[model samples]
Target: MARLPLTILGSVLFVAGCAGEEAPGPGGPGGPPPIVDANGVVPNYACPGSPGCEKAEGPLLVGVAARPITPVLETWDDLDGDGVRGDGEPFDDVNGNGEWDGVWLAGFAAGRAATEIHDDVWSRVLTFEQGDVSVAMVGLDLVGYFQQDVVKVRLEAAARGLDFDHVVVTSTHTHEGPDTMGMWGAEFGTTGYQEEYIQHIVTQTVDALAEAKASQKAARMKVARGEAPELVNDTRLPEVIDQSIHAAQFIDEAGAPFATLAVWGNHPEALGSDNTQLTSDYVHYLREGLEERYPGTTTVFLSGPLGGLMTTIRITGCPDAAGVETCPQGTFERAEYVGKGAADAAIAALEGSGATIEDSPSLAFRRRSFFIQPTNTGLALLVLTGVLHRDVYSRDKKLIPREQQALLSLTNVKEGDVLIGTELNGVHVGPLAIAMVPGEIYPELWMLKPDGSSYIERPEGGDFSDAMPETPIQAVLPAGVTPVIVNNANDALGYILPQTQFDDAPPYAYGEETEPQYGEENSVGYTMGPTLTKEFAAMYGR
Candidate 1:
C-alpha cells in the first residue's frame, strides 16, 4: 500500500461580482466559470444584522417544496447486445419480456434494470431567508448527484432569476433509485445514465427551489436529536454506527408546522439488491410516516455519516410486515419498518425531550471550493473511458481535454496529475450548526466522547496502524450548539474514511480473508479521508 504525494490546493472564497455576465455551463469551454467572479470565486452573503451588512432586521422565513423526479422507463430491448437502443433493435413484444429497460437501478450489481415502480422519488427543497441572505437546502431521492450536475442546477436557478446566497443539494444515497452517477450502468465500461432523465432532474430541482423561495413565510425553529441503534447496521469492522437522528422543525407564526428536517445515517437500501422496483427505499417510508404524524408539514430527509458501510443488509431481530420478529432482508417490509422506526424516534425526541425553540435566529454560512487528486485507478478508468462524465484538472488547475484524457493510460495518473474539484459548506442557523459533507463520511471521523477522544477503537493490522485520528467535527463547534452533519451533499466521491482503517492492501484491517474490507474498493482513494478532515477543520478555523 504505497501512498502518493499529497497536494493541497488552496480554497476559493465566494465573493460578490459584477452583474450581467453569462454564466458558463458545466465544465464549460475553458473550465467551469467562477460562481460569480471572473477568478471562479463564489459570492458570499452574510447575515444582514451581523458585521458589514446593510439591511433591516427581519424574522426567519422558511418554505418547503417537492418535485417528483421519477424516471419514465423507455421500452428498449437492446437486441444487439450494445447498450444503446439502435434503429434495428426492435422493442420486445412479449407480455413478460425480460429485456433490459432503459432504467438501470443504481446500487449493488450492474444490469439491475427497473421493471416497476414501487414508490415515486423526488427532489425536496427547504428554503430559508433572513433579511437579504437566503439559502436553499435540497434533498434528492437518488444514488448520488455529481458536482457537474450541481453546477448545472445553480446556473439554471440563476438563469431563472432566482437569487440565493447559497444552495446545498444532497442525496439520500438510495440504492434502489435510478442510476444518476453513471457508475452503476449496464456494463463495466458502458454508462447507464440517461442524459434526458438527468436534465429533467436538474430542471425539476431548480423549479422546486424557486417554488420554495416564492412560498416563504415567517417561522420559528426548534432542533432535537434521537437515537435508534436497532435501525442501523455497520458491516465493516470497528462497528461504529451513527444511530443519532437530528431533526429541525420550523413552525409558522400562526402555530402551524412549516417543515420538519430529519437527518439520519444508514444506507436506504433496506429492500436490497434482489428487488428490481424503483424506490427511494426506506426514505420514502420515513417521509411518509413523518408527514402522516405532522399533518400539513413536509418532511425533508438528508443522509448523515454513512461511510464505513452503514447499511440495512444483514440486520437481525426486527419485526417484519407479518409481525414476525426477524430481520426482513431484501423485502419491502423491512424498509417500511426501519423508515417508520426512524420517524418514531424523531417524533419522540422532539416532543418528549426538552428542546429550545429559537425566534429571529441569524443565519451565517461559508462555502469554499477544494480539489482532490483521485487515486482510485478504477475510478480513473471510468472517467477516462467516458463512463463517468466529469472534468479532470491538472496540477496547475487546467482542464485535461477529453481527447487527451482518452489517450492517457492508468499509469499516466500520477500524484497531482488528475484532480476533481468539490466543495465544503458550513452554516449556522441559530444553535444548529450544519456541516455539508460531499460523500459517505465514516462515523469515526465525527464521533467523539466528552474528552474529545475517538469512540472507535483501531484494530490491529490496519493499513495505517499508527496514523493519528483526524479532528472530530464536534470538537471544533462553538459551545451550546447542536451539530447536524449531512453527507452525500453537493457531490458523492464515495467513502470518506479514517486513514488508520483504510484496508486496501494485504493483511486487511479486520482480518478478512481473500479480500479487503468493503469500503476501499468504492472509495476515491486513501488520501480522501485525511484531506476532507483537514479541510473541514480549516473551514471552521480549528
Candidate 2:
C-alpha cells in the first residue's frame, strides 16, 4: 500500500529476538530471542550548496508492499463501435473473443513499479542515539500520488541510506490491486502480464527482506488502542469515518507480540468493482487471524484515508466474506455481516489491545517534506474537465461534463504543473496523519474543526461540522501537534470538497455539498473529511 490517501491503512495494517538473535518470547513460539545490534541505513547527505549535514550511519528499519493487483489486461473495441468503453484504443483485443468483452469492462492495465517490500526486511532499525534525534519506523505500499510520487518513495529511502522518523507507507486498498495508477483512476494493473507478476512482487519483497534480516532480535515495544465498533464501517456518505484500532505490539524476551501494527480506516474494497481474482482482501483474514491468536507474531496491515470511505457494510452486494464477487449493489447479508465483522474486529484488535512492548531507550524516526497546492479544481481539473476520466471511471459510473472534463483537462497537467500534498506526520506511534487528498472527501471533512475563523467551525451539532465518528483516531501532528483520521491510504482522490460545497454553488452550496446526486453513483461524496482539521493544520506545518 503506497500513495493515494483515500484511507485503509491495511484490511485496509510485523518482528522478533536474540543470540544468533533468535526471537520468540512474549507468549510466542517456544520463546527467547531479543538481543539487538547491527542497525544501519544512513543517508541524508544534504545538497544544493549544503551548509553541511549528510547524516546516515545505522539502526534503520524499512518495509514496503504497494498493493492493488488485479491483472486482466486486454479487451477491445472503440473508435466508438458504440459497444462502449469511453471510445478508441480501449486496450485492443477487439472481440477476437479472447475474453476481457465489446469490453464493457472499460478499465484494465498494469504499468508502474518500484517494489521492494522486504529486501533486508526492516531495511534499518537498531537505533541507539539518545539526544538530538534519530528515530525509526519505515514501511511503504502506497496508493495516491499526482505530487512528489511519495517524494519518489522518500527519495528511494534517502537514496538507500534511510533516516526516517515515521515513513509509514501503509496501504492494502486492494480494489483487486495493481496499477500504481496512471491518470484516469482504477484502471487495474497493466501488463506484459505484469512482467512475471512484477518480478514476483520484487522477489517476494526481496525474499521478505532477506527473511526479516536473517531474523533480527531484541524485544519490548507495545501499544494498544481500542474501539472495534463491531469491525469498523462507515464507507463514507455524510457518514464521516475512522474506526480507530492503532496497534503496534513488537515484543520478545518474555513479553510477546513479535510484530504487529494493525492501523485502520475502511475499503479494502471487500472484493468488488468487478473483481477478476488476484486478492489480498480480508488480508487472508488478517494473516490467519494473527496466526491463530499470537503464535509467534508477524502481521502488518496499514490502510486508512478511505476517501469517501466505506465498509460499515456487512455485505450489501458482492464479494461478501472474501468470496471476491457478490453484486446486486446492496445485499449479501450486508456483505456477510460486514465481512464477519471485519474479521471479528481484527481478532478483537488482537485479543483485546493489551499487547505491550516500545521499550524505548530513545526511539525516533524522521522524514520531512511539506508543500502542497495543485487543484485548479482537483483530479487535474477532473481530468481537465473530461469530468473524471479513465473512461469516466469505466463507462458512465457517472459525471462527464465540466465541458466534457475540459477535454481531458486540455490534455493532462501543464500550465504551471505540480500539486504537493505529502502527509505522514508521525509521533507517539499513534495520533497519526497520512494524507494524499485529491477528490472524494466530504464525509463531514472527517471531523471538521476549524473555528478561530477561516472556514468550517460550525459544530454545535445542527449541520456543517461534526459527523465523522465511525472511528477516526485523531492524531494530526506536524507543527504544534494533534492528528489521526486514517482513511483508505495513499493517493485515491476520487472525492472530497467541503468549503461550503462549490461548482458555482446554488444546487447544494459551499464546497459542493454531498455530491452523489448529480448523476447518482451512491456510496456518498462532495469531499474533504478528516474534518479539514485546521485545513490539515494549515496544509501540513501543523
Please give the CA lDDT of all the candidate structures: 0.75, 0.35
* Backbone collisions counted per model: 4, 186
True-structure lDDT of candidate 2: 0.35
lDDT of 2 at 380: 44
Model 2 deviation from the true structure expressed as Cα RMSD, one decimal place: 23.3
Task: Give candidate 2's TM-score.
Answer: 0.27
lDDT of 1 by residue, 1-542 (tens): 00111221110101111112234422333332345444332433334443333343588888899999998765666677655566656664434555535688887766677766889999999988877677789999988887667767788887888877668889999988988866667754567777778889989999999999999999888888898788888887888877889888999988778699999998998887778889999899899988999999999999998887788766663766875666577888789888988999998888875666887776777676677777777667777676766556556655555567678667766655766667788878878888888888888887787676886556676778788867777777677778878988888777877888887777765668666777776777778778887887777778
Every model's TM-score: 0.87, 0.27
Candidate 2 residue-wise lDDT, 291-388, digit = tens: 56777665666554454444534534434577664443233333344444554565665456454434642233333222222333333433332222
Report the number of backbone clashes for model 1: 4
Off by over 4 Å in 2: 1-58, 63-72, 75-98, 101-486, 490-542
